[model samples]
Target: MAGLFRRTMDYLYLACVVVGTTALVLISAVIPYAVFTRYVLNSAASWPEPLAILLTIVLTFIGAAAAYRLNLHMNVAYFANKLPPAGRRLLDLLVQLLMAVIALFMIIWGERLVEVTWHNTIADFPFLSVGITYLPIPIGGFCLLLFIIERIFLGLPPDPITHGSEAPSFD
Candidate 1:
């Protein structure tokens, strides 16, 4: 059952990556086209700037979730590196819990923001709402919280190299 859950998470992370990449590409293309039209053709794409900003925000949040799944976030390990293996494990658990708490905070605050913006719409973008623009924060925080919880349940340790052990001699 645990293995199945892990596999499902892996697939979800992969899907997030694929979707975020596609959105990034589309945003890049659209923004550039808009710029070109405005400068060269004396025409403007009214929605490009707003849409590009929205796409960028969504891509960032989704990409962050993918990174969380991959355990690619940065950490301050200079002190933890000096600890023994068991100590290292404890420290990792502590950090994971802290991260989960922080994520929860973001989720709560983000939801509040969304609620406040629920009745508001973006002035520059007619089709998009403020809620849509602010939705990614809570979603990303939720993903991050889940990832950290999984790590805690799986007893994941910080990277071994985070200990700053010397590399094996090549000679």
Candidate 2:
């Protein structure tokens, strides 16, 4: 059961990566078109800028959750690395607890933010609610919380180095 759950989470992590990557790819495409339209065509495209902002929101929140799962985010672990094995383990736990607090903060506040702004819509995309744009914050928070649960029960995922030759995994 645990293995199954872990494997399922692997898929969840993949989803985060996919969403983030897609947003990045889209932003790349949209920005250049905006530049081309403004310079070459002598007409500015209003939609690109706002669309890019929305994509940025997706990339930031979703990519962060994925990065958290892999321990790939910026880590100034210099002090932690010097600790003995037992001390290091304790510190890791403390770090995870702190991360949990951050996750809960995001979930609660993000949801409230979404609710408060639900009626509002983006100017560029009038049909899209502002609340929908804010969904990524809470969704990413939930994903991170689940990853924390996995770590608490199953320990940290394997180092990317060992699995680089095989599937994508944390690698």
Q: Which candidate is the best by lDDT?
A: 2
Pick out the ten consecutive residues of candidate 1 with the lowest summed lDDT: 155-164
lDDT string, candidate 1, 65-132, tens digits: 77776677666789999999999999888888888888998799999998999878888875667987
lDDT (tens digit, per residue) of candidate 2 on 15-50: 999999999999999999999999999999999999
Using TM-score as the measure, the top candidate is 2
Alpha-carbon error at 131 in model 1, in Å?
Answer: 0.6
Deviation of model 1 at 28, angstroms: 1.5
User: Candidate 2 has which clashing residue pairs, if any?
Assistant: none
Q: For each candidate, what TM-score against the reference?
A: 0.81, 0.92
